[model samples]
Target: MQQVKAGGLPAVSTNLDAPKTRLWGERRFRKAAGSALLLCALLLLVSLPFALIGPSVERLVVLVLINVAAVVGLNIYTGNSGILTVGHVGFFAVGAYTTALLTTPPEIKADSLRHLPAFLANSNMGLGESLLIVAVISLVFGVLTGLPLSRLRETSAIVSTFGLLVIVNFVLKGATNITNGTKGIYGVPELVNLPTAYIFVFATIAVAFAYKVSRLGLQLRAFQDNEVAATSSAINPNRRLLEAWALSAVVLGLCGALFAHVIGAFQPHDFYLTLTFELIAMLVVGGKRSISGAVIGTLLITALVEIVKPIESGGGIAGISFPPIWGLTQILLSLMILVVMYKAPAGIMGSRELSLSMFKRPRLSESTIDVASLRAVESRSERPAATLATNAIGIDFGGVRALNDVSIKVETGKIVGLIGPNGAGKTTLINNLTGVHQPTRGQVILDGQEIVGWPSSRIARAGLGRTFQNIRLFSEMTVLENVVSSALARGHLATGVESYALSLLEHFDLAKLADTKSSALPYGAQRRLEITRALALEPRFLLLDEPAAGMNPKETASLIEAILSIREKFALGILIVEHDLHLIMRLCDEVYVLNKGEMIASGSAEKVQNDPKVIEAYLGSQEVRAARRKKTT
Candidate 1:
């Protein structure tokens, strides 16, 4: 039980943190994983009878497995990677058609495909052998499809897939000599029996389960949610998408082969645009990123179809039931998918893995922080004389030296102002200082740690936090969600972690906007929300970049008061970048003037205001000359 350190906690030693463990310790993961397996087994046991007892029910169950495999595979693309792919069924069609040709007997093929090509003409094989052959062959086809289709993005890709589906169908239709044309190929040796089919189904589930916990899956999910953030986190968007594309194609290809072997028939018309939509619906209904959601959704639709089947009246006369109307079930499924999309885009568990406790109450506990621990953290902050020289170090960008080696030193608790005219490079210096952009050449030392060239995220984690010049809140999200997202990013967006985001918002006086959409927020409120987001990271040094940019004079004054209070209360070193001179004069402990990307002067507000260069570059040389002329007159 050696100590482990992660997220401020003591991390365990290498020997104690063995590969046997996952996110948690080995014991916790084992318990959680064991419970998950038990739950899956229980569900399978419960669903087995429905799949075995009746002919129609059994048929639908088998179909469900096939669809589940496809849907689960598709999640790798749509669910985790957040990309839309509609041409997936093209691979399915290829697999189905391929399996039919490979497994069909010569005699049946001769009759069925008297017009078939010579290569496909005398195909014959045992059921097991044919399935094995189709699985391998379909996978090759999947790779071929994925390789070229992955080059496009979003809407272009969607439209591109439609083009592919049409082309594939037309090609299959024209390949009468090989694919038996659109008339259909038959006699596929129906090897997908109940036992064999379920084995394949379970195997597919295992693959999906394994994938969800794998590094690939994590990368896919990260890419889908935030491409920039994911890139910073070392996840490549295009590569991850293509990997998902290839993997999903392979799995769907397996499903296609199984379906072809099960029904012993196929045609170009069977897998067209309509089939593609159905596949998308299955994925959406089950929740995009979860394998269990896909499985559950598949089973639900399958069972619904069976329930709506026409009752030939094993005939008890309470009444006779009829099969659902044309496309009735599909319409219902479509409605269900639409509802889930609006109500909970993350699906039942979002990307959360399923476990036996799906129906159980969760257990929880809390620990108390000792007073000494709090004081230990506070004691680290020294008084004015002993404190680190906290200051806005000079930052320069390409060609224009934005900061001209400007520096500031903080004594105890103080608010500093960084005022410069537009185009004076205030934002540029902030960018370089905050790790958003690297300095052409300079260093940012914090608590004896040199943080130059570090990524913005790493710098932020190192106790330097800042707000953006523009309110870069996640607009589509709620206000609280915006802050919560920041918290999640701070720790890689783990589930079940409490977002003290709301607490920060409350402290900043924006709690009333928690449920409101960020984009809908007014200007003043938006600014506060942005500050609240940065504060959620618990930074030791906070940089405010033009916080009063859009505020009225009254609002600006109120914000200045709030800023001063924050410095005193947190004992935090603060720097403000603003063009509002009144706020700068009153707020900054010391003022630095920047003109055309160079520091003209630095001193107390009154002293810098009187400097000749500062007056010449900023206020107007004419005014200074007039004052001199007046003195002579």
Candidate 2:
């Protein structure tokens, strides 16, 4: 690969670097279109045999396809965001009721005791128009339901969704006039035939697959894996989750409308817990992480359910006498789900997407350092240097002072270190600066504007980024993906982002492992990757907590070099916490010493290192202690 120099460092030449292979846009559209056509062909092929057999078999195929659409919708949220959602059925119910109310003949609606709003009660539309209305209604319900739940912790989030389902169920049963109550709505026209079902299923698959590889999908998965890191990278967890939930809900609603038509009748009980359980089981058994998993799980469980229904009805199978068995399908499905959970917790697909890329290695050019190009990219940020300062910041945790009147300043193009023994509250100070902890008695000023109580995410978006003491790379993602996700944190996902991410990777000597999963990288590489990910935020001030903690001497040296190089390239103000004094002394322009939650010393590295008080803190010199006692007396 050719190399070009931009900022005194050699970077990979633009011509020599391989073009980005994003699974979206033209290439992705082509693949999805092809997949859709292939799916259509397969559905047709599958339908022919059933069609020849009889209309009953063909109808079963159509129902199975509709189920696939619903499952795919559930998978979009559950698989991508790692949130187990049971409320999608609520959206489905909304879609079905909306479609049924609008499309039902006026005579039937009048006889059913119509009490819907005047517009809805009087309206009767074609199947296409009804479905369009369903889409709109579903999206609204999805957003409304998802907003509060998306902000909750995992278990609470799932539990809150149960409440949504219950509310929808109650509403459907209670609203006798509009829904015809528990008795069900009849005379719903069967608009979705096998061909239409095939089209809908194909469309669902296309959307799901596209979403799984979209930028939003990447951010959601990253948020799922590491919330703190994702936040620091400017990924908004609640917002991403809500988006996924809404999209999933809309798709599920469409499925529900189609299902309503297929059955020619429905009740409040149709879209409830049992259907929710079936969808969840399919997702878990087939693997919630991939479209293929959703499709496979849906087909397998659906087939089993169909087979068991006949046995439950006392139909003898292959000379085996069958007797009536209430809830046999539910029992068998439950057992199968339990078995899959025990045998394979990740389900059959695990976290892998079905992609042709998996069959062939990514085509990347031989790795080369592009220090200049990387630096060149940063040179675009010629805005005024940022100034971050804390004025007498202090916080008390249950009356124990974690930080007492601590104040420090980090200006652009400077490296500052906070060093002390393990309990000296070094990290606490960083936390206060980053808005992870709101200082009780001080101002955290960025460019002279106080931001002490701002949320961590807002602080990050305000041009401050941080890395944890323990490496927090989005471990489930590839090295490049981890950085690219960060780069897109500010909502820019243009094609240029890929090159910038690669340049950062190249600068850190990580481009060679661009496609390697972050979890699979060596510890040192993971640490560097974490730094690279943080840097992708384009922060004016970067806070690094114990960045050199687990590094060997060589790794420390390399890290120190990278820190210095990146600082210069980006004109960043850096606040670092490192136990390696030698590396710190080499890298930091100024250093602050803390002891027992107080700043003991602060100045140039040489001045602080030699101060008697500094010496006392590290080595406990008796002379220094005695001198301190004398001064106190």
Largest lDDT belongs to which candidate?
Answer: 2
> Candidate 2: where is the Cα deviation over 4 Å?
1-48, 114-121, 356-383, 398-400, 491-493, 620-633
Judging by TM-score against the true structure, name the best candidate: 2
lDDT (CA) for every model shown? 0.64, 0.80
Alpha-carbon RMSD, each predicted model: 10.2, 4.5
Candidate 1: global Cα-lDDT? 0.64
- Give residue 630's lDDT in candidate 1 (0 to 100): 91
Which residue pairs overlap in candidate 1's backbone?
Answer: 3-11, 3-12, 4-10, 4-11, 4-12, 5-10, 5-11, 117-177, 176-181
Show pairs that collide, candidate 2.
10-371, 11-370, 11-371, 12-370
Global lDDT of model 2: 0.80
Summarize candidate 1's per-residue lDDT along 1-633 as a digit string, tens digits. 111111111111222222222231123345435644653575577567777789877776677667767887787677766777888888788778877887788888888688766667776666666656666765676566666666577788788878878888999999887887878888887778677666776676666655544446644554555543333333345666677777777777778888987777878888886678777876777677666677666666666555544332132225754543666656676787778889988676565456655564432211121111111012223333212242345654445556665555544466767766778877776676666677655466776767777766676766656776776665544565556545544553333212234335555555555656666777998898877666655557777889988999887877877776566545667778887888888888888777876777888988987888877876568977899789999
